[model samples]
Target: MRIGDYKVSYGADEAVFRTGTVRVWMIVLFLAMAVFPFWAGDYLLYMANLTGIAIVAAVGLNILTGAAGQISLGHAAFVGIGAYTSAILITKLGLPFIICLPLSGLSAALFGVIVGAPSMRMKGLYLCIATLAAQVIFEYLFKNWESLTGGIRGINVPAPTIFGFEFNNEFRFYFITVPVVIIVVTAARNLFRTRVGRAFIAIRDRDFSAQLMGINLFRYKLYAFALSSFLAGVAGCLWVNFIKIVTPEHFPLHESIRYLAMIIVGGLGSVLGSIFGAIFMTIIPEVLKSMLNIVSAFSPDAMAYLSPLQTVVFGLLIVVFLVFEPHGLAEMWRRVKDYFRLWPFEH
Candidate 1:
């Protein structure tokens, strides 16, 4: 079979199960995830939780920026809204964590719709500036809204409970988070096949042309924003519960940048890229810290220099990846796999 410029073999034309290898890999991956919490230690489990949360947020950002071609400097703000809303509901309103979590996401979605309304008339840097303004406004609200957000003091988030079972430890949280990550990623993957998703892609490729083709740019853009915010909110809610805190410091502007970096470094517009990007970005710091610790063990005097070196290394990694491998780690992985699979048969 052939589609567009690519040739498709017997298994490649299938919509869901494209190939036997993919199906097997999916099953193996699912099995590994199911058993990971039981075997992993506290530190690994903690990292997994962080990766899961990042994946969710990155997926949302990919939908907005990758599929819709909207630049959002306020992605973290929606996450903050989700966290703060859930925290307040749990701490003040005495609601169940599960109930409040979804509500928090809903609240963020509503706010996203409001923010996106202005985006209908804005484009390019102007739209980015608008989103940045919302981010600043949200930060101010989180900092000054003492009655709800607890001001700069922050608020404690209780451990999540599902049907009387509490996810109080890293292991338990890992189980909860991993499944949610899988579900969210799968949903995001399938979304791109739907009409709204196609509209988003169309708008992304050429908004004016998409509009000329009868696509409702305003409605679809608003939908994209709401969907993106909802996912971000869900991630934020999970993060708050995972960390057991809701602080303004947690949703800093740098975090928004980090999320963008995750998508860019993972592969924009790809679900697999989002997941891999989250995992790589989240774990790389820990890996670096371990390496630094080992170096310090050999020379205690070098400990103070490690932090700066780590920062420099991280920046360099980003720059190098952008300049040489802008398609990101996933793309690199794909190319490497293809090279090996085809062996001496060069395309």
Candidate 2:
């Protein structure tokens, strides 16, 4: 979209930041992320932490369902696995935060492989049903396994500490979550450019054709699942540490659907779209609540109906976006940029 930008090499053509404007924007973005927590109030910081965690999970989900075209209803279970794994490592084994985080991801990845084994034989709805089964099984274990998960009572998680520096509050935790988010998002963006990434997309488009091209369907599908679950686990770890608790109720079916909605509302098969979808879904509920509170000033009854109304608006948004904008917010964003890139001129 750069009017005067010229690419002189093949590498330049494939570059992410194709122009000086994009590089400048990237720097400004990093600077903004660094500064936001410092000036934000407590409520804002809490919301920021939630949004950051959600973003990580959403992006991870995108790698599986969006890029790989796999269907899953067990994503929340994977997050739970990560949360519990990190909790156990911290409380039982007395591990440090640095060691626990990556191990949590590894644990989720292992579980992801187990859940994905069904994919070797089933696909589409059948595969989804299999994941649903996995979800139920995970829930059962979380609730009944008294020794590990603490049964129905749930486990109280301690805040993450690195080298004795505790992430005790929202602002301090911001340092942990935000930087991890940036690294994860960047890694995911780069993944799509590599052979493994392209293989996932190929299998997503048509596994038979991908297999014809000598791609191993089982291995790559497992890879997709593991990578996606790893990201989910990281997000789960962040959530457990932030809220300082681990519970079976924390990761639910609706949470899986919510992450699916994120990819659907953002844009399938797009990394930037994943982020856009995450921010959109995370912000909408708050916006609805804020509006309802304003209306409650004149009508006290509005307070009683606020929660349901928010749900209604949320559903309406998904339906509207699907019917009217199937390409999701990412497409809309691109159109806006395209229009402005040319400014008052038509080519």
Provide the overall lDDT of each model, using Cα atoms, as 2-decimal numbers. 0.87, 0.90
lDDT (10s digit) by residue, model 1, range 1-347: 21243436644563665655667888998899888888988888888889899999999999998889998999999999999988888888879877976898899999999999997789889999999999999999999989889999999977888899999999888877887787888899889989999999999999999999999999999999999999999998899989999889888887888888888888877878888888888888777888878888889876687678767866776788889988898899888878876777757
Task: Please tell me which predicted candidate would have the highest TM-score against the true structure.
Answer: 2
Question: For this target, which candidate reaches the highest lDDT against the unseen true structure?
Answer: 2
Which pairs of residues clash in candidate 1, taking residues 3 or more apart in a chain or in different chains?
none
Q: On residues 143-250, what C-alpha lDDT tens digit does candidate 2 reach at each position?
A: 889999998788997778898898999999999989998999999999999998999999999999999999999999999999999999998888888999888888
